[model samples]
Target chain A: MTGRGDGIRPRPDAAAAYGAMLAEQLRQGGLAEPRVRVVVADLLDHVRTTGEDPVQAFGQPADYARAWVRPLSRWRVLGRAVATAVGAVGMFAAVTAFFRGGSWSARMSVTIGDLVVLAVFALGAGVLPWTLELWLGHRAARRVGRRPRVPDVVIRAGVMLLVLGLLFTVFTAFDPEVWEPVVLGPPRPVVFVVGMVVAAVLSMVRQPRSPALPRLPGTPERWWERTPGRPGRRRR
Target chain B: MIVAVVVAREDRESQWLKGVLDLAVLAALVREGSAYGYGLLRSLAEAGLTGLKGGTLYPLLGRLEDDGLVRSEWVTGSSGPPRRYFFVTAAGRAELEAGRAGWGAFAARMSTALEG
Candidate 1:
């Protein structure tokens, strides 16, 4: 990946990049998308108009967002992490059931390889991205004099892809195709039912509360599904 | 060295604004009747709240609007993207007055204490 030197001028998209970064942080913090859009627009309007470097203006996007969005407690983060993990596992089981096409009582055709794949998929899809984002974003918020470079972002993304690719490649090389497929037999009803129930409960009960959107003009109140009488976490 | 100093100064200014920003913002809206974001920044800077970032101000405006203290709408600009202009609601004006009086008394007390 390469970076443009502002066409020998300077990186012109810094403000935009910062806005995108901040918007992502806010969304991850449970802010609604429309509210995020409005926030980003307001940020860009001022920065673009003034020709201000966003880092200089806001220190770090992540830091500013953390302060502005009200940091979630550690338990809340843990709950979200749990939800993502359980959801991924449940999804894998559902997909397996779909492909195998049998009654719920049928001994599921799951391999040790399938289990490996599921673990890798769960860690990759459910665990890694947001965990890294939260950790790195939190740390970066503390350091100043950071510059937004397209190449830097591209490289980080590429490294992440490489890691995931490497994991899949390793899992495939041991691809039970070469050996007697290690068979984990009979999907027991108790474990299966419990897993499904836990997943269902977590999915329903542990949803990251959608931050309430401030009543923006031209938008109707009927559109948002706030709980009856309890306004969602006041749009911090 | 120079950049560090500038950054440090800006940090100090922003820290000062941190506590009083929402109040200042509310006061600004009431005083101007209405203003867009950039216009608000300009007004605040002129009033000695320099080095305040858009990151700091915009979110507070949003929170204020969210809380029903101020309201905003997108208006077409002569150039560039449309701007969202904000106005203090009656509630917002009322909030500004109460906050203003409270802040004034606090500041006076601080000044007296500092002189001692």
Candidate 2:
């Protein structure tokens, strides 16, 4: 058989390759092992019985995995949107306080330059966490052979520290007097801590009690079926 | 031109199949009483759901289990590796009935619109 084949060779273990790809995709999607095993076993059985190339039969591993993880992905997107909104509000409040020369009063005014600075702070605060997450997730996914779910606490903490540092550097350079009072003010620090605690409590209370699945819009109430995995099906 | 038309039709059919896959899987379980993952896939194929694949069906099955519509258990036999056999719950049967009725109604409406 080898001699007859000459340059031609038998295909590599398509079944194992398919299983590996599917497992990796499922892992990246943050699906537990038992769930991954169930799907992988089914695919292996299909390959053994029909001798069909899984890639040809099932299209791409990534596409299939995306379908499976649609709900989780949606939840993650929703979480990120909420986080971004909160970050914007927090940045605005902090910058405004600093501009008011550390007075936590309602009468403080924001000039155009102050607004510009606020915008810069917002961009840094918002974009740094997201960028860091993407980079970290990519690295984790590659390292673990599947995407690892970085906890919300870790990402949020990193972003908060980085943004605070950025604000300190910028404010100290531009307006030392304003920056000094803001950084050293007892009321501002107390308020920040209290606000964070309240926000955390509210988040815990508002977190959905149901399974972490996000319902696809327009799907029937009890459908429970995943959205089809076309290229543009993602809401993001 | 002919190829394009064929491809378009296939895409449409595939989309329709995906929408109805849950109903089909439930119906299959109801008919067969119980089946393993591969068994269910084969049955669906034999029943003319050619587009059904393990990737799609298994996830749907998992969701069904999550919803308490189906129950599964790992059984070990003398010959091969243990397989998890799935059985439709009573709730699943009720859901299947409702889904069938809804699908029938939708199909009728579509047919009427297309014909008229």
Candidate 3:
């Protein structure tokens, strides 16, 4: 099928592996799903038509993805943190409700210790993307004839996990009298849905590029009239 | 020694192509009106980037797509699965024009120096 390698066909497994990894890497890089779909389709078509083994054509999926899309964009990181916070609150509610025999939808109390725990969870969620990227980077690098220091990242991740564990223990161990807020937060379901919605909205929001001047490349950052509906840019 | 020679040649070709591969892909799209991913690579190969692989080329296509330079759509013909065909946008044409001028000046200077 290809000019150089006529009549060759790609192994189905290789094509599948390449396509899946490319899609994942692209998604993690913060390209929206539809864009990711189209980009992946284009690459797969190239492989099918050219009859090139996916590996022969693409060195490593993560490396190829990094070349195309900058991973761990700010918007994606925010979305992740919000999603994790929502999950943590839901789990905490479920456990408490099970123990106290209370309705799952009951309103939650806002203790300072709870806030501390929530913040710790959200912070952990925020760093999750970077952690995943490091793992992917190490694997991709090793496969592609490059050696990255994997143990250092492993050590760092272990330390972070231990720190998170210590924080969780300390916060939960504090007595209820220490810092319970007087006000009760919203009911569980509403808060959970709202948090999820906020996370969804965050993922969709584009981080604004540095405002390009009307004239050219280099200019001071100036706030111009922003276009409606698009939250990212302030271009005239 | 043989593996080293091959790796060196590969690196040299990619390094030289790095600056212009995206531009060349853009030029091919502008010239052809529209083409699929593999078809575009074939055109590049015919234009002397014969060793260009899909791995290198797709990322360039992706960057072009992201920059609003080229737009793509899926088309299904009588056979095979649907393929994405890319068309150069108006902005892409403007960028290509600017690139053409830049390349011409740079190539002329390099040519003069190499022959001198």
Question: Which candidate comes out best when scored by TM-score?
Answer: 1
| Residue-level lDDT tens digits of model 2 in A143-235 | 322334666568768877887797777766776445333322335555454545434432321221112222222224443322122322221
Q: Per-residue lDDT for B7-69 in model 1, tens only?
A: 999789767667788988887776677888767877787777766666677767777887899
Q: By DockQ, rank the candidates, best first.
A: 1, 3, 2
In candidate 1, list every pair of residues with a backbone clash: A6-A10
- Weakest lDDT window of 10 consecutive positions for candidate 1 chain A: A1-10
lDDT of 2: 0.59
Better of 2 and 3 by TM-score: 3
Residue B41 lDDT (model 2):
73
Q: Going through the candidates in order, what fraction of the true interface contacts does each contain? A: 0.60, 0.31, 0.63
The lDDT, on a scale of 0 to 1, for candidate 3 is 0.64
| RMSD to true structure for each model, in Å | 7.9, 12.1, 10.2
What's the true lDDT of residue A79 in model 2?
A: 59
Docking class of 2: incorrect
* Tens digits of lDDT, candidate 1, A1-236: 11111212224465566666676566566655566667777767666666666676666766777655666677767777767777768766665555565675667655666777777777765556456656655544444355444334675698689887898688677745753475766564544665566556444432332223333333554633322221224335
What is the DockQ score, from 0 to 1, of model 1?
A: 0.40
Docking class of 1: acceptable
Sequence-dependent TM-score of model 2: 0.49
For residues B1-116, what per-residue lDDT tens digits would candidate 3 score against the true structure? 99999999989977878888878999888777898877787787778878777777766776687688998877786887777788999999999899999999999998999994
Q: What is the RMSD, in Å, between candidate 2 and the native fold over all Cα? A: 12.1
> lDDT tens string, model 3, A1-236?
22333558978666766666676566555554445556567667777777877767877776666765675656656665565555545555455434544576787666676666666665555455345544554365336434555655676688778987897787678776776664557676665555555555434333322111122112232443222132111111
Most lDDT-accurate candidate: 1
Residue pairs with clashing backbones, model 3: A1-A7
